[model samples]
Target: MTENPYLSVFTLTKYIKRKFEADPYLRNVFVKGELSNVKIHPSGHIYFTLKDDKSRIQSAMFRSAANSLKFKPEEGMNVLITGDVNVFESSGQYQLYVQSMQPDGVGALYLAFEQLKKALAKEGLFDERWKQRLPSLPRRIGVITAQSGAAIRDICSTIQRRYPLAEICLFPAIVQGPQAAPSIVKAISSAESYGSVDVLIIGRGGGSIEDLWAFNEEIVARAIFSCRIPIISAVGHETDTTIADFVADMRAPTPTAAAELAVPSREELFERILDRKRSIYRSFSHQIKHERKRLTTTQQSYPLQFPERLYRPFTEKMANLDDRLLRNKNDITANRKHNHERLDRMLSYYSPLQRIKEESRNMDLLVERMTRSIQSDMCKNQDNFNSIIRMLRALNPLDVMERGFSIVYKEGNVVNSVNSLKVGSTVQVRLPDGTVEADIKSIKMKDKEEDSNEQ
Candidate 1:
């Protein structure tokens, strides 16, 4: 069997890539398609798919080429693209390496502007709630535009003419082409860095939407939206609209109008001040007349004309109240006397003297009972004590000794038994009056009858 394969998958893809690159028509092809799945890289490269109704092709725009684009590329935009068509080696598919792109029919800038407007609006960037109010009288006006452009001149001149005290500081920027958006953003940042601008005028002279596209850029719109200084957007003619107009603090018809919005006209202000003075005078006159009428009416009124008459009702009412109070006081005194008499009678009826007498009798009785009890307790205790003392005296050997009985001791111990006395032992004899020390002569055991009787 012969081998069926002739080439690897990479070899076929390489061949196709070489064929695509070598073709003269594919080298620089112009195609028109609607953009889809567009993605912008942080490195400024662009990746997107170009699609018509029936077919699509992958496309890439490098940073170098994309950086030159006058408009931001967005999805679903019908655009004319110029690029090289070649097979991407990794994907093995032919795609466009985009060099440049332009809107097919509608202006690219207008499409970009509308697309950005919709996107930013969806993100709540264009909400009226986020817009700041322009200062009524701005002290410092920051102008962000080309210093050479008519916008700065118109703004400065208008501000000077309308309100000469307004200090104008210029932040020079590129107002057209690809560099315009970043330049304007940097200018705004620079303006903010200088730190004294009360209001900012961002604009360019009348031009095409493409010429004013920098104002439409997302960066510029965000910069305008984020500015701490109130911003007035003036781009192109009155009819021209951009994203900057939507996000700025105020949108003016033209550069001159922006300056007018930012600063008040001195002449008009002076006229307003005059009108205010006239109004103040009229108000003062009216107030003075009204107050004078009030004062006159007050003076003519009965209370102010006759001071004693004003107090007549109060005096009469006070007299009536005093009369009623006197009557009430007398009645209250009578009633209080009656109540006091009734209370005294009740108190007498329930007086504690009887209770005290009864208590005293009961206390006396209790004292008598207690005295009898004490006397009986003392007599009984005395009898018991006397009986115990008699018993003790009867049992006492000292009493026996006083009755002429003696106590015999052998070596300071009692000799209760005859066996306790040893012959020839010295002994002590204790009588009631004195003690005798004697020598033991004999000791004999007593009879059993006598010992038993003694025990």
Candidate 2:
């Protein structure tokens, strides 16, 4: 058999890929389509289908090209793509390897600006709460802009004219093109790290958006936001707005206006000082007049005109009290004298010797009567004592004991009944002359019927 002439699948695909690469028209192509089935891979590659009307083509943007894109691509978005058509060798399919992409009807930069504005706003970067208050009088003003531009000149001149006392420190930076954002950020950092400037004025003269894009950069915006010193943004004209403006502490329409905002006016300060001085002088004069009126009123008052009148009433009251005291003393003396004379006369009426003699006679009579009465009472008492002694002798227990009767004691107490004596207990028997100790051998109690019959 003859050798097979058919090409293998890999050989055919390789041939097609070479053909697509060789065609100059396919090498650089521009296509407009609506995105579909868009997917962004974790590796930063974008894969999608580009469709318009009835036709669709597979497309891809590798990480290198995707990184250059300013706005994100989404499904159903109308976009213009620029890339080369090539075969995906493994799949044997031709696809557009996108190099650049932009929204179909908008400038890429403007769209990027709007998209960034929305994102940062949603993150609260544009909130009023994050804005710092500008100093009323900044001592050192730092300026960040082109080294040799109308912006620097205008700002320096305006500051010098308005507030000569403020020291201007120029931080020269590039304010245009791609390098401007990094330059502005570096200048802001230098000013912050320097730690001496009270306020910063970052701005440039009026320009197109393309010329002023550095101020809109996210890095520059964040730098302004993170600065410790207060920042005032002045870019382009009155109508221009950028991310830096939104994040700065304040915004000015022009560089000159930024300078004017940074420091106070010397003339206005002088006027205020003069006004305060005048107010102080007027207040002092009014106070002096008020004090003089008070002094005059005091000098013309009744107490000052006739000073003795103030103490007259007190003096009269003192005199009256003294007179009452003297009268009370004299009256007390007369009463004391009268009492003394009466006591003396009564004492004279009873002489000590006569009183003693009379008392002695009365005492003798009383003694004699007491002696007779005591003797008569003693005789009567002697007769009554003899009768009681005889009666006691008849009733005495000892007398009865002498007559052949005895007393029995148990535990030192007299025993009156046989029931009080236990058979094993010891007791004492008392006679007229002696006590005899004995143990009870037995006890006998009288029968209740016999005792009752005897009673």
Candidate 3:
């Protein structure tokens, strides 16, 4: 059998890629779809998906084509894309190589506005913490917009009507088109160079997003954020907002509003000053009245109106105290004289002769008491001795011998039992009258005759 020739997988892929290149329709195709998974790489290449409700295709825009885009692409945004459909040789995948793309339904300017707004917002450029405070009353108002436009005219007239004393310095700028952003920035820097303005009114009259896009430029947003002078953004109508509005210190709906915000009304300020002056005068008057009333009361006080009467009571009180002191002194002297006489009599009664007689009598009484105590103690001891003598006689051993019991002794030691004596031992017997000496003979036991320990 013969083997049939077959192509390799890579060869088939290369063939499909070549077919895509050769087909004129696929080489230059137009696709209308909603953008999805849109991503712009650091290398300036854009990767995204072009999808309709029913289907989607992988799409890519190289850096060259992407640089020409005036508006940023976003996911879920409807767009019309011009590109070539081809097979990615490496992966064998069919995809779109996009060259040009523009928003399909919405204006490209609006898309760019939203895209930059989102990016700056994420960067915290729109944070309220970064917003500066508007000056209460600016000395010179710096206006950054076209010189001949209605925006500048409105701002100047409004300031003149509300606060006529303010100085308006116009930094004439191109307020529309590609050159508007840089012109506005240069004007801002110029205003800063002069350094006379207290606050800046950077805005234009109401216009479309494209017409007002100068303020939406990134340079303008950065300039507003970095401005030393406070900025009041007045761009477009009340319903319109831009990147400049978010980055500015304050946002006014109109150029007139922005001018009003930069300066205070002379009428209101005058009224406020008058109110404060009236308050201060009222306080001063009240204080003066209070002090005057206090002075009147002091003048009518008792000490000031009746000085003689005030001292009369003190004089009478001093005279009464003098009389009482004289009486007290006379009584004190009489009492002292009586006490001295009593003390003299007491000294005479306690003379030395009388004291000696009393002491000698006390000594004689003490000696008699001592003699009686010694006699009573001797009698008590004598009676105790007689009673002890009777007890000793009752307990005498000779008394027991008189009852026919005798105490035996062996070699001068007392023997109370016959078993205590051995044969041929000399013993002494103790009787009531005298002691008799004897010798111990042979011992014999009488059977059943006598047991001294038997019951």
Point to the candidate with the largest lDDT.
Answer: 2
TM-score of each: 0.66, 0.64, 0.59
- Candidate 2 least-lDDT 10 residues: 415-424
Tens-digit lDDT track for model 3 on 179-254? Answer: 9999999999999999878999898887777788888888999988888988999999999998899999899999
> Higher-lDDT candidate among 2 and 3?
2
lDDT of each: 0.88, 0.92, 0.89
By TM-score, the best candidate is 1
Model 1 C-alpha lDDT per residue in residues 1-455, reported as the tens digit of each score: 99887998899999989888789999999899999999999999999999988999999999999987767887788899899998888878778999998998976666666778888999998899988887888788888888796788888888889999989898899999989989999999998999978998888898876677778888888888888888888889999888888898789999999898898999999999999999999999999999999999998898787899888999999999999999999999999999999999999987899879989999999999999999999999999999999999999999988877898887778887776666898888998988988887877666889979999
Backbone clash numbers for all candidates listed = 0, 0, 0
* Count of clashes in candidate 3: 0
- Cα lDDT tens digits for candidate 2, 321-394: 99999999999999999999999998998989889999999999999999999999999999999999999999
Alpha-carbon RMSD of each model: 9.6, 9.2, 9.4
How does model 2 score by TM-score?
A: 0.64
Q: Which pairs, if any, clash in model 1?
A: none
